[model samples]
Target: MAKKWFLAANKKQTDGNRMEAPQRINASDGINTSASLETLPHVLFADDDANMREYVSCLLKTQYRVTVVQNGIMALELAKTTRPDLILSDIIMPGMDGIQLLQALRQDPRTHDIPLILLSIRASEASKIDSFDAGADDYLVKPFTPPELLARIKAHITLKRTRNQAYQAIKSSEELLQSVFNGVPSSIAVYKTCYAADNSIDDFEMFLLNDLMCQSLNRPKHDIIGKRYRELFPTASKLDVLDLFKEVVYTGQSTSFERWYETNGKNRCLRFKANKLHDLLIVIADDMTAEKQLQIKNEQMKAKQLEMEARQQREIFRVTLRTQEEERRRISENLHNGLGQMLFSIKLNLDTIDLSDSLFSTEENRKKLKNAELLLANCIRESRRISHELMPSILEDFGLEAAIENICSQLTGPCNFVAEIEPIVPPADQEIQLAVYRIVQELALNIVKHSQATEASIKIYDSNEGFINATVSDNGIGFDIQKEDNNATGLLTIKHRVKMLRGNIHCSSQIGIGTAIKISLPKTIDTY
Candidate 1:
């Protein structure tokens, strides 16, 4: 006779229930189900946006244990300590974004295998390219509906579980079915018969039972030895879930559950997995209740943050434009006060010498007059150069269009310059104008200094965005942008200027390939 064995449940060991069930179901299916299942596997999510975290977390919670954190720092700490089964992180965040965090984790052998995903609204083709370049297992674009997020998570989790092979202690293949069934950490009571294959599990059991299998469930050891699990789960006595567990045993694969339910007046919902052992169904469940709520709040928070960021960017852009305009003003003042007057004085003296020559006679005097004229010519050229350097006079009231033409003329020394622009400023935000000017200036300088190219273009056009955009593309030997820039202020300067304009700066260059500095600045009252 199999000795009837049962042990009382222990809730104190649950650490003051700091991780109590997140869902509360009327425990009145009403039996004292003190037999807690095993602890659930841990998963960590790092996303700056609270709302994204909420959606992903809630979806994942249905099947696996989940933990959603605000940023990479918490994700790292959680991964190091709790050693979650998987880690899902969004790329960009406030303190420490996903890329940096992933690098750190990978460096430490402890958290290397954990998978990282970048979740962001930066879904443009270029942005996607950048995210993958930064070392990510996968990338999730922003505005992803809950179903899409859930599907991606499921694919990754399945991959992770398949990759992870925990050592099993069951005996021979003969007892494989029962042994696998009973080996899980849930209060699963698998019946001896089943007709379904491993892949198709009964829908209801697929959900609840999987949650029960995650490690979060707690149960006494002896109570499971001989007692029928339904005895402990009186309300579930009517549930004939035995067949699903049996299928898992026969298939050597696993069954899953994703759901929300409240029991014992305690809210609990989690992801779970069940595999069969010789005569029992080994059950495991995750605690998802907390993760779901957190994911929701997180997503909401993220939405607000994105809106705030957009506004800030607009403001920064406006400030930068104003700054550039001030710079232009200063340069204009210098040209007028110093260079302009000096050139004018030289012109006047030459004019007087020519007029006086008509009244005087003598070869020596004529030669002297010629010398003065030549000197005046030099002064005029120098003044023009100075004026151009301070501020391109063409760009003053004319805006960015004519200024680019001047830049093209100057670059003619080494490379043939091509310039184009649309002439229009709707009192156009100054930041866009300045950013376009500065960014173009820097790219040209870099080409002259490093690109070793002989040709370039400063093209500008306007679209419905009501914004001025510029691109300085050069046909020069390009260099790797990814190379570490310990002191590369040139690129940084360009980037800063773009940031200030609440604009974007993009550089695409590779060894032997030409480089292009593409910039887009919003023309509105946006801040950085």
Candidate 2:
């Protein structure tokens, strides 16, 4: 006969006193149980015998919060819901016995970590072996002492709790690392170095690529990861990008540089930094194509603006030359017509008076008439000279060459001025012809007044390069051309006229030596 098991339960005594049931603390309530209650781990007990279930639950409740079930099936279901710290199930039951329950619980991630112990009346080695093979943490025989059962439960529960805490810490650390990796804006990649048979690093295999790197490459993570550098970007072999990775790995130093690549029918400029971590290489890259393009555009705009400004300045100079030429023509006409006519009429009226005739026939009257005629003649010559100086009609009628020769013949100075003019046709543009003639005239005057030289020469010739070149030289006391004051209006006017003709002038002079001025003007001006 089997022994009947008796266990304590809540009941009323004959003296009307109530027996207290063991306290049931709900671990999920988050209640701050006493230190003794906090130490009480939750346990699930399963058995086919009602008496045995009651007997064990009563004893285990003193040390642990106990939940009892009728069979292994009930025990497995309750274990999943409560996620108890430990499970104790009978080896033999009507269905889904202890070994089967252990296998099912171990297969589930939720209950696999819960420490399990097997209890049965069959203490055979085969039964024990089956319990351990099915993933039992501990096994015990029937009618075991309460102390032994409590000790085993405590040990396994402590171990399980320790492992759970360690797993949580590692999960938190991984989450933090993932956040940092995704937060960076630049494209980043990590590669593991691969070597050739000769032990030299030949290539690299991708270990990790951040989201930005995938987007930059226009490839998915699955396609990029575990791919060789050259395989993913065949063009990289031509660019020798793998060399950069090898250098970083071998030297244990970081390097940065700019590179250009053509992708998807567009050019991209990237600034890259490469560093090595043992056998792995880390690369960070930023796209700089937009920045470079903007800089190039700005430079183009500046050049265009400078060109426009130069055109405007030339236009202003052309208008000024036209106005000056018109004013000179007006002054020349006034001097030649109005003033010359008046002087000529005065001379004719004087000539009409007969000093030799009767009225006086005195020596003093004849001498006075002769003096008056000389004064009128001088006035008439002065008027004509002023008109010619204001605007040389010879320049317009006979061209630049004839005008130069005429001016040279009319020089009334100690300087022996000579002209070696080339008989080229005058420029088609009247403005150009006038500018060249005026520049030469100013140069000749400067030589006469400032250069106390005995000999001066002017040469005008056609250069082979579609330009007319003129040079003026004098053997005289040359002044410092650099130190010449702004008040030197004659030289300044010469420079201004040359500029108007789109010509260039160079003046060289030294004290006690000689002065030479060279001018070159293009034959045709660009009107556009």
> Which candidate number would show the highest TM-score if scored against the true structure?
2
**Clash count (model 1, backbone only):** 84
Q: What RMSD, rounded to one decimal, does every model reach?
A: 36.3, 19.2
| Candidate 1 wrong stretches, greater than 4 Å | 1-384, 423-427, 486-489, 526-528
Model 2 regions more than 4 Å off: 1-40, 120-134, 140-144, 188-528
Compared with the true structure, model 1 gives a TM-score of: 0.34
Candidate 1 local lDDT, residue 312: 73
Per-model TM-score, in order, reads 0.34, 0.41
TM-score of candidate 2 against the unseen true structure = 0.41
